[model samples]
Target: MAYSIINCLQAAQDGVDIICLSITPNRRPSGIATFFNPIDMALLSAVKAGIFVVQAAGNTGPSPMSMSSFSPWIFTVGATSHDRVYSNSLCLGNNVTIPGVGLAPGTYENTMFKLIHARHALNKNTTVTDDMYIGECQDASKFSQDLVQGNLLICSYSVRFVLGLSTIQQALETAMNLSAVGVVFSMDLFVTAFQLNPVPMKMPGIIIPSANDSKILLQYYNSSLQIDGDSNKIVKFGAVASIGGGLEANYNNEAPKVVYYSARGPDPEDSLPHEADIMKPNLVAPGNFIWAAWSSVATDSVEFLGENFAMMSGTSMAAPHVAGLAALIKQQFPNFSPAAIGSALSTTASLYDNNGRPIMAQRSYPSIDQNLSPATPFDMGSGFVNATAALNPGLLFDSSYDDYMSFLCGINGSTPTVLNYTGQNCWTYNSTLYGPDLNLPSITIARLNQSRVVQRIIQNIAGNETYNVGWSAPYGTSMKVSPNYFSLASGERLVLSVIFNVTNNSSAASYGRIGLYGNQGHVVNIPVAVIFKIL
Candidate 1:
């Protein structure tokens, strides 16, 4: 039956162009080889037909021997974060009150000092004092008195025991008992740490840098040593310096290493032990922190709180991007087969990282052999997919549907019989009777392997003088024309078809549209709904 179908398709391949496939895996019982699934059979068939297939690497990582999107006949992609740097310090102003510690209205020398506010210590009504040492005060009565009356408390790290006793409940109790407004505790010199009230506090508290703490302490000490009248004076010191964004934005050009979270690989060695035998992850695409069109409903929903848009990190996001580019490639070279297109995309892709060096080791370090590196065949295949390169004439490979079926039958040791040719609804196709008359014109889209192929027929009721035919496919699906301009003799019928291979199975569930174009801008369209189901 497969042989008959192949013969029919070959006979009808007059004006056919390209074929593409999207590959995926099927579920199987444990301890069994998983290579004979339907999807795998379809992919092998598409490759034999010489079509292109694009695929996505699975999002399983942060460990050794992970199974990524692995398929020898398709292109795969990885993800990355945007090259943006975050600020380490938050800005503060003079109006921000530091009640426990006195700021003698003067700027002072910078020194490292830890910051501890009453809020962090779980105390509410504590005050600060220069003479009050940390970890030394034993009596709650004396400590409570010092905490309430003192403007600021200065103590050695040893007194932390007294402060540590101030639990949330105790702090609340102390707040009521002392009627103090605020507190400030100095952090240990070796380690800097602070915490805010788990619950809201009536008074505000902040964590300042050690340098700020030292400056405030020095100014307080200087003021206390001065005469009474000196308190009114405002001392000026050098301005505080900070790193700005404008200067740091150039960091990408300086250091373009892969982020810490991206997956790394060397085929067979890094891939799941079972996946070592397959041609894993045919290629790689930009999956890192990529920005794309998001659903308005999902973005605008209140569940996100105030954020309307969000950035996600995963291979899932990267899969659709490659799908969209496949559509573009299809549009440019309609005659290329899906396997050819896949090969073009992989072989023509750029193997170099942002640093202009071959991507060898996983993550972003350089290596000696481009192919032998752990990340070579697994983490990334042929580097990142280049849309423009795949569209170029030099990168095209053309194949037919018969070629694909032959490949599928070869892999599974199954011969295609009339019973094996499933119809649109998975019913058997009747070869005896011609199919129902398709309204206007219709195309049957099918996937034998990981590639999508269309079976289109043109009836010439009007004496065919080369009538124009045109259509369009969705964003991720591309189309190509074989024999772009064909001369159909009068009263003659022509059967034309093209196949689109799925490159990345990760995005197979996405909806795509196809557009057909012909002489004088004539156009027609067919919607392609790609589905990914786990068998």
Candidate 2:
């Protein structure tokens, strides 16, 4: 934390415009909300000094309650993608071809080898170790060398996707150890990560992400002509390759959606009962398969040379895009505070994917239910970052150091006592001011079982005009904003009191959005999530 703080401070002191952090503390299982941990505290402190902090909402998503960087002061980012995928096609022995991805360049011509399925290789035993099945191509030494030698081996990839070459390489090493001519690994999930296309195929292999491809290959392996009155089954395979690549916003998908690995929110802080109803991941950007500059240092690790760029996927890639967008926002509004800048970006961001459907995120990592449900503000925060639209956001959800300080005093029994609390007494301010009432553009209730009013104030940065209120309440919850329609002059402010009345039918937690609209596509979406709990 100290090291991160020092670097951030130094950069700010050097007159750096923005701080985009792609790194985080790995020791902790999840991110600390605001001041509970050193890094978040340091970042919150830095934000107070007008240093815009754009961070990655860790890549542990598609899982419930897995999010980091929930601090309202920070602009947390999530990743999204399109249908565009890097294709590496492979030809089968039956003159059939299937799409695949590999790092090996060129072709591995007709070199026939008998196909061997992992199920057949397993020792004939009624009971076997778990690793015996999962470790087929993963655990090379376990294979029957005499039976596998010079044959094309088919194995299942151990995880969802290849996180790195080291994982796939391990499987390759196993194939090599068994004297197998090559291997055909199948992926359990579709990932937009890069596939290498290095020449002289590394261990002569190819990878397919579809389960159907595995079934097709298995069928062929089960077909063989009887020879010498002996019913025999043997499959022949040929020409294998590998490649590298990634993708985001193919702009061709039925709808734009958050990648499965992108972190989500309801702010993990909701783990505590009656805690702050704070939503996180302040924004979203195209992070998958992003092409950027890479290390040029010559190394034996990769198969190709003279390549100084690569297409990669992850939150790290997404955060920098936000950083650049933040820098651009700063360059235009040189006098705006960090919070104001963030508000502008969020307030004017885009909400619809290419298909005109609301932005959606995957339900869970291993889910195949393709009809993805709409993404809540928890997953998308404001929306997709729009550089031009952010230049002039009509209204700003502005807050100051004092307001945040008051917030610190109101969270679940105050943030952390060590946050310069000795200088200021928590009782001096509205100890009643909870975390969600920090003058943000959104409203939330960590636990809502009854009717209540959420106080909020919006500043009109645009010239005197009439802006109407519109909203979508979560199921079983009725909500309304007092003073629904308001007219404000330039540099004026308006207080819109929001009320949420829960219904007895309310069961599980619900999430929805409320939008304030003006002409010329000016829309401010406020997210509200009510944790249905027995009070």
Note each model's CA RMSD in angstroms. Answer: 17.8, 6.3
Error of 2 at 281 (Å): 1.9
lDDT of 2 by residue, 1-535 (tens): 5687678667767776688888644334332333456666667667767888888887877665567566667778888865554445556667677666554432345555566766555543322365544533667656678767777777775443234333565667777888877777665433443323322245656776566665566566555422234544333333322222221122345445787777777543355532346666788888776666656674533432345765666777788988898888788878788888888878887888876777888765334336367777777877888778888788888887667667666655454463453256776666666666777766767767577788877887777777788888877788898787777788898888888887754445677777888754467777777764446
**TM-score of each candidate structure, all chains considered together:** 0.41, 0.77
Give stretches of model 2 more than 4 Å off. Answer: 25-34, 91-99, 103-205, 210-219, 222-251, 267-269, 273-276, 298-306, 365-371, 412-416, 420-429, 532-535
Which ten-residue region of model 2 has the weakest summed lDDT?
241-250
Q: Write the residue-wise lDDT of candidate 1 on 206-304 in tens digits.
A: 122243453564355443332335674323221121111111122353122222234433232321222342333444554543444445466232222
Highest TM-score scorer: 2
